[model samples]
Target chain A: MAKTITQEFTKGLWDEIPPFRLVLGLCPVLAVTKSVENGLGMGVAVVFVLVCSNMLVSLLRNIIPSKVRIACFIVIIATFVIVVELLMQAYAYPLFLKLGIFIPLIVVNCVVLGRAEAFAYKNGPVRSIVDGFGIGIGFTISLTALGALREVFGSGTFFGMSVFGPSFQPFTFMVEAPGAFVCLGLMLSLMNLAGNK
Target chain B: MVDNNMVDTNKFIVSHAPFWHDGSKISTRNYNIALAALPAILLGIIFYGMPAVGVISLSISSAIIWEFVFRRVTKRSNTIGDGSAAIIGMLFGMLLPATAPWWLVILGTFVAVVIGKQIYGGIGANPFNPVVVAIAILMISWKDLFDFNEALMNYDFDFAMVYPLAALKHFGVSAVDSFNAGDLLMGKQSGGIGSTFGLGLIAGGIYLIIRGIIRWEIALSFLAGVFITALIFNMTDSARYAGPVIHLFAGYTLIGAFFLATEDSSSPVNFIPMLIYGVGAGFLTVLIRNIGVYVDGVIFAILIMNLTSPLLDKIKPKAIGKAA
Candidate 1:
């Protein structure tokens, strides 16, 4: 049981990463990931929610009826989402502002809901929590990777620090939507090649 | 597996068996999409008045005309009846402001159909969303054309509604006092031609969903991502940022999320990946809107997501029973 829990938590990091591997919670990964800091903040928020939601869902898996499970699950998921929203407002106001609608939009992120259905419902509490942590960590790392790449190339900044020499001019397009998609595509392909290896 | 080339060769010979039947009739799916854009057309005219009509007409006309010219120049068969060019024009028009220069609108149509759509072998073959690609080209090449401040500076008594960007530009980047949230929602604000009129845009969106031209997942997730982000920003500092409602209605959020970004050819076909595409567009739209120096997020968002549609298609989960 202990080994299973460890495996579940670690899976989300690479084998079932929410962004690069599983391709879940992409809304924020692509949206606010213009800067490394924004990506880190979003990843942390998602991980927090994933861990809490997974634990709660695992605890109540038996009591929740299969017939109306999705609706009940949404309520449970939404409660955690609201808590995340409030916590962001209370503590990380600037990051909260930066993430914007994305925090509440987490309710619809599919990764959270996908995990609830796939892992938490059938797993024990300890396993579920670890699973969530792994997935969240995986998601955070991927987002930060993409964000750092885009930010450095698009804006000549690394996590908001200027790294380029004076002659280096940022590619404005990299900071925009086109840059985001191109970066994501390249990242996914790289991951796919690595995974295949 | 059946050979695709052999299948095509057989189709030309008119394979009689129903299992092997294939036809060359041009698909009307694109035309049906144009028909769906009618509600957005009506809403634009009603809210922004006659200038809106002129912009749409010019765009559509330029698009169709450009399509004919491109076919002639390329020595390719004419595809005017396909309605793909017309759809591109209408969508491009829907994204521009009512006050945009007529020639620029024509240029936008030309770039959309000629370069963005037709250059890649027309319509479905195009890799980027046509409207967004055109808008981006126009924006990067003709900076003054997209300056909403100049266009909306007059502030006529009846049209005093301050567009989000105009307000932002007028008040400078740091000041938030000039923004009027009401103007943004009610469509009295100055922005893109068809993106305003919040209620009217929603009505158009609902029509598309009801007609089965679009799924609610992409539309809803896009809105959810954008709205949630905007709400958080507003809560953190309402002074510098407008609320979610304003962000949604201020510009092409409704039209783009519902009609433009949802273009079948430029989007993914699978359900889960399709939702990802929509949410990605929505999140990008909001991110660009708040942080970037610009007022509009729709065009950039759509173009960016369009680039990923192929990747999204590749990732679509195989049906439960299908072999991976």
Candidate 2:
């Protein structure tokens, strides 16, 4: 039983990584991942929401009826999203402005609700929290890597520091909408290649 | 028994479709295209001087290198000997300013060969012309680099310094009068290295058409489309829109009509679809020039048409001896 719980916790890291492997929650993945700062902020927010929602959903599992489970799960998830939104607004006002509607839209992020329905609803509170953390961390890693790549190539900077010399002409396509799709596609291909090996 | 064994061995020799050889080879086609482009390329060198030569050489070498490296990395067969990479590099170089930076040439060729061609599984498989794709991306990403006015600012010319397309785009039709149709045809205008030589490009295009290297239908229809569309716009508002002759001789129109639009594997194989694709591209080019933000619409227009090529190729005439 202990081994199964541990397996659930670790699966989200590789077996079911949100953005890379599972391809879940792509809206924020593409939107806020233009820079490392925004990606990190969004990733942290998602982790907070996922952990809280998963724990609360697990705690109320027996009381919530199965037929209305999705509805109840959404309410629980929305509550946590709002908490993260308000906290970020109060603490990180600039990031809140940058992230804009995306933070509020986290209520609809499939990853959070998916975890609640698929894992938290039937699992114990501790296992649910671990699962949420693993998935959230994996998502954060992917976002940061994508953001770093875009920033370095698109603007010749890394985490706001100039990495290349002044002579470097940034390939601005790396930051545009098409660039986002191409970058994500190339990353996905690399992941697939690695998996095959 | 010896006769029977020989017949069985001959029967065992398997072959695919197209068993009949027409004596056409990819290398032959590529070399012919290079030969056809010589006049315009020579004119570019004469007008732009050594920098033009440098850009062209670097573009060709870098394109070939990129394809070679990509094939090596992907463990695919080496394709550098076919000369398609050289042709792509040359075409891409022709589209750039004579004063293009070395890095831009290298990067543009990389985009043309690797992202534009190899990523789509290499030559003959790409849905769009590789050169067009690279040029479009460069134009979008670094508009300033492609802006002939700034890129060629250091050079002195007997004619007006402003590129004809830019002048028409920014200052209206009146600004284009500085360049007459004769001068534009004679390659006296300010533009890309090879695109300015209208007469040379037309001659090259005609040579290719004669050699059966490209379809004349596409080239003729594209020009016709441009002429008719520009004529309408000129009639509507002569003060706002330049005439058809100016439109044809101004930008990448000639090069695009002959070399870029008729790129095999991205163009239609049927008669009606070919006409439609060419006319559509020419129409969009004029439309984008007159109203859209870009100064010249050749690249975008060709790309748009290329996107519709697959769908248009479906409009086939009924096959002979087949039910309608």
Candidate 3:
């Protein structure tokens, strides 16, 4: 309880980075990370949802009955997800099409729900907002890193630009479903290695 | 559990009763398996010439290098001395087309050594054969590269002698007459570098069995499964299915039966489980070849059976005096 607000914020970046460290919200991590753009887009959307939900949840934490806390949390998270989905449709139609049902499914994302129950419900709104941004940015970084690795090898491209040139044959397997798991595993181990030091 | 007298005791005073070490090391077993595979490899090199030798050597060397680098990076104890990487490399090379490109060979070995073997805790801990894993992934990624007929078309060959499996799959049983059983057995067929020569595979398989390096039950029962299934289909509708002999000689059938299916650790250990694994792989191989979308089913079939081997191991006999 004596921990500073900065410590709470910084923990999400490395000490408890989602997907790689905390290992939460893997549904979006594995599903939408076929390319770097998709990863970034998905990451930014989650950031919006997480920050809003966290601030709202922290403010209502004292009012909502403990028995109905989960139901209340879902309602808060679902509203933010709808805002994200509609905003994506208006501003980024192509990316929205690429991410599809995954944007709506963010309501069920464990990382958002986990932070709501574990962090926001216990902390002040200011700290909760900071925690959401920190964790949301961490999720974005992990997703982008995974997507970059897969895109470079799997498609021989980076953000639609060819990195390996014309002659390079894409390792098609890296873009497929199994490649996502393999990439996720390798990156997880690497994160653990860095964390160990 | 009470069997201890069967241990081959030396003249010296022995402390252990039930333990049996045939004075064989892991390296020795690896070397023996490598030696057994030599006849087929040599035949492949003779037929395909320099390209064949290049693929074999590159795959073997790269496989070793990958294992050594991975171990060094992870700071695990050096296991390259055991010769398992060499065996994996050799088997993978033999399975590839002689014309396989340089990058594909390097990448395939990386997949085999790193993803397939070391990632699963190295050597005996892998759930599926390393060679099979690489092949299956490569097969999924690059279907065109594996099409033998297309890949090897430039070589001096008769078009009439089409890839036996593709021919049968596309043209039906009428294409069977174009193939000679004797030619297929003697390495006159078109296929993977070492997989074409049926006689050499049989020789290598027999060597492995005789050395007691691999259990004969798995290999023979696998062949039996292929033969029986193919035979049953041949009798029921000869027009639709090729005969049992072609099923045994063509594509990856013989190699899958003898080498790939018999990989240690991934395969069942007990007697009954071994039989079931072998037969199941063989049955699926034929089933896939006849009806499935793929031209040859040996690798996929063996991989599927490898998945089932752990569950099949549970089918062992109950302990004496224990409740059922």
The DockQ leader among the candidates is 3
Number of the candidate with higher lDDT, 1 or 2? 2
lDDT, each prediction: 0.75, 0.87, 0.89
Ranked candidates, highest DockQ first: 3, 2, 1
Fnat values, one per model, are 0.00, 0.38, 0.54
DockQ result, candidate 3: 0.65
**Whose TM-score is higher: candidate 2's or candidate 3's?**
3
Compose the digit string of candidate 1's lDDT tens values, residues A53-86.
9999899999998888888778888898899889
Specify the poorest-scoring 10-residue window by lDDT in model 2 chain B: B1-10
lDDT ranking of the models: 3, 2, 1
Model 2 lDDT per residue over A85-126, tens place: 999999999999999999989999999988998989989899
Candidate number with the higher lDDT (2 or 3): 3
Clash count of each predicted structure: 8, 0, 0
Model 3: per-residue Cα lDDT over A25-132, one tens digit each: 999999999999999999999999999999999999999999999999999999999999999999999999999999999999999999999999999999999999
How close to the true structure is residue A134 of candidate 2, measured as C-alpha lDDT?
Answer: 89
lDDT of 2 at A111: 93
C-alpha lDDT (0 to 100) for residue B202 of candidate 1: 69
Task: Please provide, for model 1 over B106-223, each residue's C-alpha lDDT reduced to its tens digit, 9 standing for 90 to 100.
Answer: 8678768876877666655677888888888677655655666566455464655565654653564344344455655556666666666666666767776776666677788788
